[model samples]
Target: MNSLKTNYNIVIVLFVSIFSFQTNAQSAAVDQLHQLYIQTINTGDPGNLNTLYTDNVSIRNSDGSLLTGLNNVKKQYQATFDNGKYDITLKTIEEQDLNEDYMFVSGSFVFTKIDEPEAVQRGTFVNILKNIDGEWKIYKSYRYPEITNIKSIVDGLYKSFAQGDIPSVLEAMDEEIIWNEAEGNAYADGNPYIGPEAVLKGVFERVGAEHEYFKLDDIELHEMSNNQVLATLRYDAKVKETGKTYNAQVAHLWTIRDGKVSAFQQYVDTKKLNDAMSK
Candidate 1:
């Protein structure tokens, strides 16, 4: 009995020791990753950045565009530096380990353009780091634009539309646009609208005539896969002739091509739209 007890105790001790060691190692690795991120941003050294990124790194911009490949990442940042000075500072908000090999870090960054002292902007970034060859390197990264800017652009769209600035609204869209509303009203066969005229006919023309007192509220943006953006907006409008108010939810799926909105699709609340129209 004494011998058996001794063996059992030894096994328990071994298990506890192993678990503790793993926990400590993980903590240390996360700390190292945080430090490495700080170092890379502060130095702005391409070589250092390369070392901290995987060979197949993917970077998603605030505009929902993606830059993939280590060489591409380097080139993009190099161009930014070449064109102007970028003095960036970062503050880590949270870090989560997805597994032993993968982790995610989210934080806010302030970028100060050297030439424009008053052009300092703050944004949030999320990076997925992978442990490769016993070191952590960024595998994927995403940046979100400041909420204020996003709101400003959205508000501008409403203002432009209200003022019958058709050209301005067209300019804001991607060339290949997919406009979807909750009302089951899909334009251009639920595909991309190739040019401005098509967008104007499908989007501005249809909505402008169908509803009045057009107001967009409760706007939210979700970054979807492959540089696509899903914008959820509460739509409130009334028929110009009937004074019938239409309150519905809409989701706009936007795809950007050549820095323009190339395609748009909308999803809307058909039941709410019908009820509002009937009234």
Candidate 2:
């Protein structure tokens, strides 16, 4: 699963549409194409997408996965629907007609889970459509990253941590970053570690001192408002002295400012962690 472990941040970009919708002759066709996009996403039916695309349509996903051709794109959507139902809304910022035969639209989209309104991922999109014979078809679809790009940043830090490059990892944070550990956690000695040094000493150092074979896995990032990112993952660690191990679900709330992480808050299953720490 290519999950963002992605970050959330506020950002704005100029919409670039390739064709002029001003030529009212194309409005109905364009609107129909837009409606088709909405229907395809909401339905999560891969087969429905086949009608929207040319035989050799190109696609790029938010998670950076790529699929070329109509069939491949269909399978991607099918997998999405098989996993969960997505209710997606599309907002077109601009539209342009590249020529009499081609058009482009760039805009934003938000995908929300039908079951849980809170589960949402918002992103930008660029679509290129072709007029083949008589029907408008999607020739290219690209998903662009948001302004804050928290997912990429957090994923970088996770990689650094895995490599034991604490110094490099700390570079991604604000000098006066505020960090908090989960309540009842062994590393809560400095609940609000005010800076990198404090976080390193109070959390990283303590973990290294008391644990062996500690690892993080199955990490996924969800973007939230006010420049915050929510990451859900699992922590697997074996306490050194007690030889007790626990694999617990963990959540980290990260707030970014000027591209640097300004604050971090951890949420984990503390009871399980506490039990693992006990002698």
Q: Considering every candidate listed, which one attains the maximal TM-score?
A: 1
lDDT of 1 by residue, 1-279 (tens): 999999999999999998788667766766676666556555665667767789999999866679999899888877866767657777778877788898878888887877798987777989888989888788999887664433345456657866778788877765445554334443334344556777677666766887766787787777666556677888878876667887786887766443445556667777766666564
At residue 152, candidate 1 shows an lDDT of 43
How high is each candidate's TM-score?
A: 0.58, 0.50
Tens digit per residue, CA lDDT, model 2, 1-279? 234222221111111222233455566776787788788778775656767889999988765567898878777777778888889888888778898789887889888888888978788989898889978888999986465476778778889988999897788887899999988887887779998888888888888999987998998988888888898999999999889999999999998765568899999999998999888
Best candidate according to lDDT: 2
Off by over 4 Å in 2: 1-22, 148-279
TM-score of 2: 0.50
The worst-scoring run of ten residues by lDDT in candidate 1 lies at 181-190
Candidate 2 residue 141 C-alpha distance from true site, Å: 0.8
The per-prediction CA RMSD against the true structure, in angstroms, equals 8.5, 16.5
lDDT of each: 0.71, 0.82
Candidate 2 Cα deviation (angstroms), residue 14: 32
